[model samples]
Target: MTHLRAGLVQQPAWPDKQKSLAASAEGIRALAADGARLVLLQELHATHYFCQTEDADLFDLAEPLDGPTTTCLAALAAELDIVIVGSIFERRAAGVYHNTAVVLDGKKGRVGHYRKMHIPDDPGFYEKFYFTPGDAAQQEGLGFTPVETSVGRLGILVCWDQWYPEAARLMALAGADILLYPTAIGWDPDEEGDENQRQLDAWTLIQRSHAVANGLPVMVANRTGHEAAPDQSSAGIRFWGGSFIAGPQGEFLEHAGEEPTTLITDISMARSEQIRRMWPYLRDRRVDAYGHLTRRYID
Candidate 1:
């Protein structure tokens, strides 16, 4: 019965980079003290959720792959002797950026990273304007590949990618031991209460389904608090921080409230193998008949 203790940091971030990073560092330290071998932080923890509005100057917030955020997390992973997964706004080249999740092993520094494949351009979440969708051509087959770390093979994905089961399935098929999502999701402050609840419920339900289908544990870390738009064009988003961990059978291991929190739990890695034997979804898959999955539409 192999067990891995994992920690998730869900917190509010401010516009100030230094203050925001300090808050995240504090949570990482606390989790490490509690004996967590792996810690996952919310998306864009080093700064505010600036995607509320598309500003040309906001690109200034983008950083290189080995920039300050990765540097800071690598130091913490080394000092605490733990594996850390974090998200960053990556500046790949001039006028090209991506929403990337980075993984660091204890003393190994930056192990690998996954650029977000699904880019969303919704009312409040204007992500497509800033993030170029990750392409297999650009990464040279690294797209959707799980990162190998001391703790386990991390199937790391970003915020908007959480809604797609194909993304989760691809990671699972590629031999990911566990799935992790670093997210910045929330409700529109003006929406009716019932509608907001439905959205939140759907978000939780979809991710849990991934765990059950793949026979793996799923960890999600979301930011909390309300963030106003830079231009004040509309009512801002109230980030619902329901960070959680679900087991292989879609059972909740730990679930958090809307407030900022640090959640920790031990996941039974062997449970996945045991459950896969009982439910054998992989053995029953009809892969030969699903060739049209690559098509844009079946028309």
Candidate 2:
């Protein structure tokens, strides 16, 4: 039975970049000691969630592909001998930026990256102010393909992309054995208790559904803590860090609480194959009749 030990580092980003990187590196080292071959860090793990407000100066947070953040991750991956998926706010060019995930192979160093395609712009998540939507051409140009690592083919996606079934299906079709989401989502402090729970439940349910639908194991790493607004115009977000790994059947293999922690679990590639064979949802898909999906609406 082929198995892979995966690790998730769930923690809040600090105001200091070096401190946050140090924390993440420590978690990776611990997981490596426990035999985790692949580890994932949360979105923008090097710094605080800066998207809470839109400030022109915030663009400084974006770094180049070969910037300090990726440089540190690459060196850590090499030292720990673990495949690390680290998210970054990429400064693609002077004015162009993106929410990107860099995959560093332990032996190969910086291998490839996945530019986030879905850019969300809500009250709290003002991503549009900082990112340019990644298209197929840009992805191809940057080699944003499923990275083949020691564990399996990794279909790495950022936070907002997890909400789209189309993205999951595409990755599965492209031969990804597992799905990974590096996220930094939180609850609006203004919402009621029930509403907060509902939002969290929905987030978990949708991701689990992706696992079941695609017949692949799903891993998520989310930040945890309350990051206050700098200007205090509104209540800040409380990051709900329920980092978890779910099986191909949407069963929870391992789960974490709303605190800083490292979660390590072994997933069976053989089981994923068996489950997919038994379900056969992909074999029964009616692709010929789904051309309308490309249209904005059927009207």
Ten-residue segment with the worst summed lDDT in candidate 1?
Answer: 135-144
Give the per-residue lDDT of model 1 (tens digit) for 249-280.
Answer: 89999999999889999999899899999999
| Cα lDDT of model 2 by residue, 177-279, tens digit | 8999999999987887788899899999989999999899999999999998776867989999999999999999999989899999999988878998999
Q: TM-score: which candidate is best?
A: 1
Candidate 2: residue 239 Cα off by (Å):
0.2
On lDDT, the leading prediction is 1
Where is model 1 more than 4 Å wrong at Cα?
Answer: 137-141
Global lDDT scores for all candidate models: 0.92, 0.89
What TM-score number comes out for model 2? 0.97
Clash list (residue pairs), candidate 2:
none
